[model samples]
Each structure stands twice: as C-alpha cells, then as structure tokens.
Target chain A: MDLLPFFQQLEATTVGRVVRESLWMFPVIECVHLLALALLGGAVLLVDLRLLGFGLVNQPVDLLARKADPWLLAAWMVIIATGIPMFLSEATKCYYSPPFFYKIGLLVIASVYTFTYRRRVTRELAYGRAPLTACASLALWFGVGFAGRWIAFY
Target chain B: MNFSAFVQWLDATPGSVALRESMLGYPMIETMHVLTLCLFLGMIALVDLRLLGLGFQSIPVSEVAGRLLPIGLAGFVLMAVSGALLFYSGPIRAYGNIFFRIKMALIMLTGINALVFHYTIYKRVASWDRDPIPPLRARLAGLCSLVLWSAVVVCGRMQAYNWFEKAPGA
Candidate 1:
C-alpha cells in the first residue's frame, strides 16, 4: 500500500510548495489561524456560558444565540480558510499524526454540536427548560481545543 | 539582589532537574501549553467578537458572556497547569528569556483587563443591555484585549528564538 500519496499530491502543488518553503508564510498563516480561533472562542464562550446559566440570566436564550451567531460564522470561515492551506501544505505529516486527526474529528463534532445546540437545545431552554445540551457542547469544544494543542506534538 | 538569587535557587531545584530529564515531558508540556492557549484565546475572542458585533447579534451581551465562562475558565485551568510545567522544565532559561518574560507580563495584563470588564463595565452594559453600540469603556477594553492577546501569541512564538546566550563580559 502506498502510504505517501497525500504527501506526493502536496509536493505537486505550487501553493503547497510555497507554504512549505516560504519563510514568512507559516508565521503569517499561523497568525491568521490564531485570530480566527479567537473569534470562534469568544463567540462560543458567550452562548455556551448562557446555556449553563452563568451569564445573561435575564435575557432569553434564543435572543442570545441569535446575537452571537454571526461572529461564530465569521471566525469559523477564517479558520477553515487558513486551516485548509496549512493542512494541505503538510498533508502527509498531518494525516499520519493522531492528534491532527483527532483535532479534525473534534472540529466536525463541535460544528454539529453547535447546530444542535441552536436548533434543539437553545429553543427548549428558552421556554424555561434546563439546558441539556450545554454540557455536551462545552465538552466537545474543549476536546477540539485540547486535541488542537496536541497536534503540534503529534 | 535577593530576587536574582532566589530566581537562581529556584532554577536549581530538584523538581526542575527532574522535569528536564523526563523523556516526553517537554514536548507534552509544550503541546498542552499551546492547546490551552488556543482554548483560552478562542473562547475569549468568541465572546469579545460578539461584544463587537461579529456574531449572535440578537443575543444579550450578558447572556453571551455567561455561556462562555465555564469553558473559558477550564481553558485557564489547563493553561496554568501546563504553563507551570513548562517553567519547571527550563526554569533558568525561561526566566531569563525576554519573550517568555513579555508573555507572562501580557498574560497578567490580560487577566487584569478581564477582571475590570467583569466587575465594572459589564454590569453597566448589561443594565442597558441592548445598546446598538458598545459603551466607550467596553469598546476600549475589547480593543485592548485583542491587542494584548495577540501580543502574547507573538511573544510565545518568539520564545524559541529568545533564550539566554552567554555574555562576552561574563
């Protein structure tokens, strides 16, 4: 079995070459990645904390969710854009790395959790039911963050 | 005079020696540090961006802040643990590193800024609660936060290049 196909594909791409070879590219892209992460982190903190009944006790849950949605979307967009290129530049390394794989998996789970939290959980909680999804949402995102950090090592 | 000596003594401690000698210790600690950083910064930015009107427009500032607190705190916890481990592994070197020093200073500033936001402006803002534009203080805090945190990240990245070098005079 050819284990290096992804690496071969990466080697063939001009952008991949630049990402790997350019002195400034990694730092610049990493900066963008961090910025995007900040945006995502901030937005999630607001909504998730509310679900846990910490902040904005007076405000309706749905209203809070609506307010924070845009920033989350923008942050995710930036993350995807910057993250994909970084991933592509070192596909082989990333693919073989367990932490990288876990990060990607957690990210997908987080995205799904975000949607579910909004649609099913937030709406139910707005009517005065206790938020059941808050704990899970928090855990998923934390996993994403933890796994993301581990990627550097793995 | 005493402070410098104390720093030197701490660096020479057995715990520090053990930390450096552990096989996977350094890499694991570094990885955890970066992860916590991402978590801490990520959560803060999400909340802050909301305050700045990036997302969740219909949500109350208080509500948004409330929801993100636990995860943020958890991130902080992880950071503290991992960060201490990092310092332990290279006490003398990190202590003398300019980038590391700067990063620590900025982290303190960020914490202070956060406390101020939570205690004062946040209360007032929540009362008004739906202002089209964030209050002057809130906006200022937000801007300061973004700059300080970004500075922390830059300093962190620069740490690898800023370790102590032998002085010619010494």
Candidate 2:
C-alpha cells in the first residue's frame, strides 16, 4: 500500500484544511488530545502500579485492572478521536517525522502488551511476573509519550 | 523590588537567559512538566473519583486516599520543580501571558479546594470510608476538584497558543 499519497490526500481533505487553517481548531483538538493523554496515563499507571504492588496494594490486581479498564478505554477513544484530526492536518509532516513513527510503533506495542501479557498476569494473580509486566508496560507507554513530544520538536 | 521589576530582573538573569536560549533546556523542562502531569493528576483524579463514589467502589475511601495521595504529592513536587524552571526560563513572558495568569489562579483555587477538603471533610473519612457514596460535602469537593483541575489543564494548554497575545493592539 502506498501510504504517502494517502497521507497527502488526507491532509488536503476539508477536515484537514479546516484544522490547519483555523487558528483555534488545531490547538483545541490538541488540548483534548493532551487531556486524554493524562487520563490514559492515569488509567494505565493505576493498574500497572497495582501490579507492581506500589499502588492500591490492598485491592486485588484484577479488581484494579477491571476498574481501570473503562477509563483506559475512554481515554484511548478520546485520544484517538482528537489525534486523527491533528494528524490529518499535518499528515505529511508526520509521515516524514521519525518521532511520529516511533510514537505509533510504541503505542501499538504498549496496547498489545497491555491487553495480552499484562491482562493474563493480572487475571491469574501471577505475582512472579507482575513486576516485569508492569515495568514493561510503563516503559513502552513512556516511550510513546516521549516520542509524541519529540514529534513536535522534530 | 516591585513585582514587575522582580519579574524583569528574574528574566534577565544569566541562568534564565541561558535556559531560555539553550537548544534543549526549555523543551526538556516542558516535557518533564507535561509528563509529570500524568502522574500528578492521574493519581489525584482517582482519589477524587473515589470520593465521588465513581470508581474504586470496592475499596474504602481512606485506603484509596492514603495510598494514592502520597504518590500524587510526590508527582506534584516534580511538576512544581519543572514548572518553576519553565517560569524561570521566561519570567516576563509567563508573567505577561493571560493564560499563564489564569492557570496560576486556577492552580491556587485547586490548592485551596484540596486543603479545605483535607482539613474538613477528609478529616472525617473514617465515618464514611466504606459508604461508596460519600456525604454531599465530600462529593461536592470531588466534583469541584475535577472541574477546576480540568479548567487548569485547559488553561495550561491554552498558554501555548497566542490567541490573546495576537490582539489587534497591545
């Protein structure tokens, strides 16, 4: 699939045009994106910290994960929803931006790690693997955030 | 010295000028500020939600508050340090920015809100720790905190834009 053209066309679309041209639109969407990032960070950290036995230790890991699931899902929804337009507005820039690719790659890895190994360990009360999974999850997500910031600077 | 003079002087200091003009200093501090925000607000949001009987219904409010508030406070310290660096790097610009002023005021309001809840309703957590639904005052505090903090985040993000600064005539 030739994605370069797709990115070019995406940026030329009306949504992209409006987002890029309007003074408030891009910033407003960015604000929502950042707010959701914080929420997502919170949701992910809560469960990860619990798994590491550093947060809500008295509560069952499964229970903490279950409660955080909704918030994590909600924050992801908002982040992606806002993120799309922001990307569309500058798709070409993102296409050429190594940091943007790094962010997306890390986000994919983080999501898969969270739902797969992290979920299973939490479900089965696997204490031995808990710290490792939690640390991995934190590291992957941290990479995503760091790269996201780098995209702006790059 | 007066406030304006202090800010002007602060902005002119070698340290401040170096940080502002350095290739990586401002953005690095900003990244720290933004990243720590997640830890700070994320933990506090959880406590506030529990106070509002929104999430963490299975746990006692006291435990939730006890375990989480300390981490949140630690995050706050990091955030405050990074935030102070950001201000120091550009004292005059930050002091003059309307959004920055609004963000500071909102932060103060949230601080007062947190203190009031801590000294008043939160002091009595043992009474309603397991209720799942706190009393009206406690819930109100939680709601106020959520709203105020959201506003603070909005104002903080707004500081990046030059909406007001681009006014027709300064």
Candidate 3:
C-alpha cells in the first residue's frame, strides 16, 4: 500500500505541521534524549556492575539499587517524553524502517525485563550470591543499546 | 604530513569497497556505535557525579566506580566494534571528515583522562571512601570527564553532516 499519501495528509494537519516544521524542535529534543539515555544507562550500569561483583563489592546490592532507582526512573521519564515527539516528527520513516521496528521491540522487552526481573536480581545480590537475573538484565540492555544504534542506520 | 592524502588512500582501499557492500553492515555498525555512546556517556556521568558528591552520597565512591566500570566497558566494546565498522564502510570520507577525526581524538583523550583518574586521583581520594566530599583532584577529574564526554557526543552528532569531497576527473 502507498503509505506516503497518508503521511503527506498527516503532515498537512496542524499537529503534523508542528511535527514537520519544527526543525529546531527535533535537535533540541534529541539533545535531551541523549542526556536522558545517559542517566538511564548510568543508573542501570551501577546496579548491574555491582551484581557482577565488579565494583562496590563491600556494599549491599539492594542499597545500591535503591539509591540508583530514582535517577533511573527520572531518566526514563525524560527519554520517553523527548523520544515521543521525535518519533512523531518522522513517524512514517520510523514506521517503515526495520531498524526502528527492532529498536521499539527491544525497548519493550527491556522494559519488561527490568520491571519483572530487577527485584529478584536485587534479592540475589543482597544475599551475596551470583545473580543470573542481573546478567540477563545486562544482556537485555546491551541488546537495547545495539538495536537503538541500528535504528540510526536504517 | 598531508592528512587529506591519508584520507584519500583510506577511501580507495579495497577493504572500503568490501565494507560498503556488506549487507546491513553500515547501519548495524552505526546502530551499535550510538548504543555504546549512550552507555559510555551514561556511566561516565554517574561516576563523575558521584565524584562530585551528587547522587549516591552515602555509597563509597570506589564502590560506585567499581560497579559502573564494567557496564561502561561493555558499552565501550560495542562502540569500538561498531565504530571500526563505520570507518571501514567509508574510510576515506570518515578519515577526511573533520568531525569524525575530532570525535576520534576526543575518544582517545577521554581514555587517557580515565586512566589518569584511576591511577592518580582514584586511590588517594577514595581511600577516605566515606567522606561525603571527594578530594579536589578527583573532583577536577570528574569535571573534565563530564566536559570531554559532552564534546564526544557533539562531535559524534556532527559526523552525519561532514562528508568528504571528491576530486574532479579523478
């Protein structure tokens, strides 16, 4: 099906025009997007690395997780808020891009993995045992990062 | 030495041709690069912020650094691999491209800065571990890290716009 026509029509609308004509908007939002990603990535890294017995070997894992959790959530909020508008600006291109599709898929999976498995991982870390869940979380987040990069190329 | 000639030579290499032809190669590499960049920047910020006495004030700086380092390394691996692929895809253009060169230089500087921080300041300041305020040297390193990484990101974003020019009738 010819999707360009639909996109063109959308681009003509007030909301669409804002998306299309807001040239200055995307770059500003992109800056924020990167900043937010840094926050989120940083928080996850701190907790995950501790789980692997890399750093903070003396501290309790649960405490580290609790300490970093708020920053992670806040960063996630910034990422989503800025990301949605950027997505809207080039909805058609992203919708049709395979890399973009994979990025979105990875994002969803990562989110689910974080929310469901994080608690269990924290428990294991607190007990001073090797946590498989933490490893898995790191792997999943790595996948998310990889897929996100793929999106730019596609 | 003429850097432009080196760039031209790199572009003309057979490997460049092979890189460009690989299916989904360029995009895949680019994607990985961005992903790693995110990781690198994110982890660095967290560590530096800790050094500056921001979040995780209760936790020992060494502990936070220890935990965050691996994640940063993982991200670094992704970036290095992906970045190499990107360079391979269009060696000449990327080599000649000012932004790409600047980004590369900054990345190297960032590495040096990191090593220096680890060797000189980290142990001395982190010996106190529980001191809410880190040593001045550590704080200086932290500020530098923040600035250098920000420059890396800006240079990376600028890469898309800086294309190499072709010689006429070559």
Who wins the TM-score comparison?
Answer: 2
Docking class of 1: acceptable
Quantify all predictions' global Cα lDDT against the true fold: 0.73, 0.88, 0.74
DockQ of 1: 0.34
Looking at model 2 chain A, report the run of 10 residues with the lowest lDDT sum.
A122-131
Q: Return the lDDT, model 1, position B150.
A: 88
Model 3 regions more than 4 Å off: A1-16, A22-24, A120-125, B70-78, B108-123, B162-170
Worst 10 residues of 3 chain A by lDDT: A7-16
| CA deviation > 4 Å runs, candidate 1 | A1-3, A116-118, A127-132, B1-5, B23-32, B35-78, B108-130, B161-170
| Full candidate order by DockQ, most accurate first | 2, 3, 1
Residue-wise lDDT of candidate 3 within B33-146, one digit each (tens)?
A: 666665777777888888888778897887767767776777778777777778877877677678887988998898898899888877575476777778888888888888
lDDT digits (tens) for residues A1-154 of candidate 3:
9767775555456654685686456665776677677778778876776677765667788887887888888988898888777776777777667867787787888888776678656755673745576678778777776766655556
lDDT of 3 at A111: 85
How much is A18 displaced in model 2, in angstroms? 1.8
True contacts kept of 1: 0.49
Least accurate stretch of 10 residues (summed lDDT) in model 2 chain B?
Answer: B161-170
Model 2 alpha-carbon drift over 4 Å, by segment: A126-129, B166-170
Q: Which is superior by lDDT, 1 or 2?
A: 2
Tens digits of lDDT, candidate 2, A3-91: 89989999999999999999899888888888888889898889888777787887777878888888888998998899889999999
TM-score-based ranking, best first?
2, 3, 1
Better of 2 and 3 by TM-score: 2
